[model samples]
Target: MNLSIFFEPLNEDVFANLEKPRTLGSYISYFVSKFPDWRAADIAILGVDETRGRSNEEQAEDASTAETPARLVRRKLYSLNKGAGRCQIVDLGNLRPGISLDDTYLRLKEIVEVLISHNTIPVIIGGSHDLEYGQYMGYEHLERVVNMVTVDSSVDMTEDPSVPPNKRQLRQILMHEPNYLFSLGQIGYQSYLTEPEVMATLEKMHFEAYRVGEVHRSIQEMEPVIRVADLLTFDISAIRHQDAPASEPANPFGLTGEEACQLCWYAGLNDNLTSLGIYEYNPELDDRELTAMMIATMIWYFIEGFYHRKNETNFTSRHFTKYAIAFTEDNPDRMTFYKSKNSEKWWLEVEPLSAEKGTRIVPCSYEDYLQATKGEVPHRWIMTQARLG
Candidate 1:
């Protein structure tokens, strides 16, 4: 696919003042005078300037005049020093917004699907959170069940006609036909902001939702949740307003800047994660570009984590420690677990309900193994079993 046709070449004036030595901009293949050769790139940076998803007309009008949120983020990202990894990155430039919001979604979906099919991970920046629905659609033709994780303050499941697409995109994903979504895990949702019925609906679907306080208490626990995902969508609103004030509905209480980056790091290390979208940033509301800088740092951390991936999925290898626990007394049902010697990550094997289904190796934490050793079945195990059935 000729991706350049769908994109607008980045305005050089936006980044012209940047000093290139040792900075990320020096190492990146970007669209300036001509489109970069993205075919060989390992990571493609995509910018989306669409914001019509916002219900507030005033906010949308302001976005039209202000510098695009994506450009602001790119400026900050380019100024950071390059990481340890040899960068095979390409900045595809901002996608041209279509005449209608749904048109924009289809364009994004097509671009993301093509990028993933070529084994290039797309690091999407800007746009409203509803754009994630397009990101989710990218996986439709991949011929596998998808696991998704979203970091947001409120569940975007509103049924009200007055609500904009950004506020109800999750419902669209859930009801999307040909249902390839196997599991969805939400992180950093504030209880007060979420509706009780939405929580109940997610529970009924056998999905996972972690409260903001729960995530903040032990951010490390989120590693397993992120590791199992095939895609991750982060809403800037999930970060505290003080840290990321540019969001549509910036919350007073949410993940700290540090915690948000930590989650991105975990997402980067996951071998299964193919695409990432960070959304809902409005440059008009930013305080001296602090929110833009924060988003840039989060992207930097994700790239650092990507370079540090251990690729330790082989359980039978000598680099892993295996444990067999008998969780039942009468039938003595056995469970197998593996811990990576290199990265110290954990995984457990769950037996499928039928022969055709086979066994599943699920990402887990050391704490889960401790629970199993005490003659208890871990909740994660039970959840996986239910989903498999």
Candidate 2:
């Protein structure tokens, strides 16, 4: 019911801080152009001003302009609201001399506050994962802040000085909130986090993690774990190296290209969702066609699920899906195949006992899972299909 746009300036310092260069804006623009429906949905962008870095010849030409502001400027890019869509551009020039994190946070906070007040979900094209700290802070006003889900190859919880400045100080977000906190598809385990402390911390917090194989095994088991989530943060590193190879660690594992897009689509399908972010991509690492193609696909699927979530998104039929049980109790290990054509949601599509809805005791370890499958029976839905708010 409420919506607007905001922009964040990106530049070299931002790159230096984040350990990656700006890559999301143009891709987003391309995406909007490709799928005009999403353009009609929301408008926002974040980046640094390029005008400040204009070449000598360009600066001279600008100076020759009759208008003072035109004469002073060199280059800057803003979000284009070409039609009924609200296109808001948030771009900045070089850090004037020097800027503090406090200043940066303040600037970001102002825009975030507006989104929160309007209760509008933000689809962020990130500058750095550190921006997450500020983004999380903005949601404090909510009575219940949903669990935070971060998908990356490394634990990112490390704040090693040797690490780049803009790299996520991921450890800071690790706190027990009586909320459902989880991470997935971390592949560069040994190299990125080589300490017992990291594993111990997750164990202590009851946080579960997955390497590629493990995450896949748990994919069907994720309905309830994900149902409790409040917001989703995708580091892009969760993407395979071939798809988004420019991530901070640049090492991605778990899931194939199809699986990666499925994750984005599923995350957007959650009902209790607040916002989504895709971060840690370095355009500099990509060639023209390959790199952009991968991230572009991710965005496309993300928007796909979001649109479907707006409705009950259903399909006549899809491949049979499995909903894993949390425990091996009376319900032994098994997978439910949807023999009937029903709800398209992988989880909601399957019926535990019979082909009809409301038959068997739906398999779920958590309450959100039960709620997520509110309308259907067991084996009829994908875990992600039901658990979201």
Candidate 3:
């Protein structure tokens, strides 16, 4: 696929002030005269300009127009120093929005599917949060179930079909068929901004939901949650307005800048995760481009984690220590867990009732291990079993 046909070339000035040596810009292959060679690249950057998914009312009410999110992100990224590995990254430039929102989604889906098949990670920036619909659709042709992890303030479901895309996109993905989504994990949700029923729906589906408070209490626990994802998206609105004022429908409470970066780092380390989208950034609302800088730092951390991937998920590998626990004969609940000797990260193993397959292992916290030792089952283990069923 010739990507140049669907993308607008980067403006000369977009790279004008960038430094030459050791900066991210020096490491990036930008689509200036032509599209970058994605086959040789490990990661690809794409920008989307469509915003029709945003509520028309909010678009009309905001006096200040939104700035091009991808441009702002590029400016910030180019100023940063490159991480320690041979990172072959290509910037695909901004995608040309289709005549209709659905058309744009289709274009994005096609582009993403091609990239994934080529083994290049797509680092998507900009467009409305609903643009993730295209991101989600990218997995349709893979023929395998995908686990998606999202960082947002709400589940984004609505009873009314006519609601804006941002409010109903999650519902759309959940109901999408021939269903390829194996499970979903939502992080950074605030109770005030979310409906109780939405959370209930996730629980009923045996999916994971973590509130803002739970994340704030111990953000590292989210590392395992993110590790399970094949696809992930972050809504800028999930960051507190003080740290990221660029979010539309801005909120005062959410993840801090540092916390957001940490989450990105965890995502970067996940070998299974292939695509990441950071959306809902309204640069028109930014203060001194602080949010843009914060986002750039998050990307930086993610790249750092990517280079430092340990590849220690294999329990049988010598890099990990295995442990097993058995409950009383009456209880009948037995569990196996693994801990990485290097990173100290933990994983719990579950066996399905059927003997057709081996035990399924999932990323878990140390607390889950402690619970298993005490003859109790962690909710995460139970949820994984339900998902298998």
Best by TM-score: 1
Q: In candidate 3, where is summed lDDT lowest over 10 consecutive residues?
A: 56-65
Candidate 3: TM-score? Answer: 0.95
lDDT of 1 by residue, 1-389 (tens): 78999998887865676776889888889998799988899889989988888873433333334698888999999899998788889999988887778888899999999999998999999688999999999999988899999999999988786888899999999999889999999999988998999999998888989999999789988999999999999999999998889987658899999999999999989988999999999888998999999999999988888888888777889999989998666866788999998888899998867677978898999999999999889989888888888
- All-Cα superposition RMSD per candidate: 1.8, 11.8, 2.6
Q: Lowest summed-lDDT stretch of 10 residues in model 1? A: 56-65
lDDT of 3 by residue, 133-243 (tens): 999999999998899999998888777767788788899899899898888999999988888898889999999999999999999889989999999999999999999
| Least accurate 10 contiguous residues by lDDT in model 2 | 70-79
TM-score of 1: 0.96
After TM-score superposition, the amount by which residue 236's alpha carbon in candidate 1 deviates from its true location, in angstroms, is 0.6
Q: What are the runs in model 2 whose C-alpha is more than 4 Å off?
A: 1-98, 159-162, 165-168, 175-194, 222-224, 252-255, 310-389
Which ranking of candidates, highest lDDT first?
Answer: 1, 3, 2
TM-score: model 2 vs. ground truth: 0.56
Q: How many residue pairs clash in each candidate?
A: 0, 33, 0
User: Candidate 3: how large is its RMSD?
Assistant: 2.6
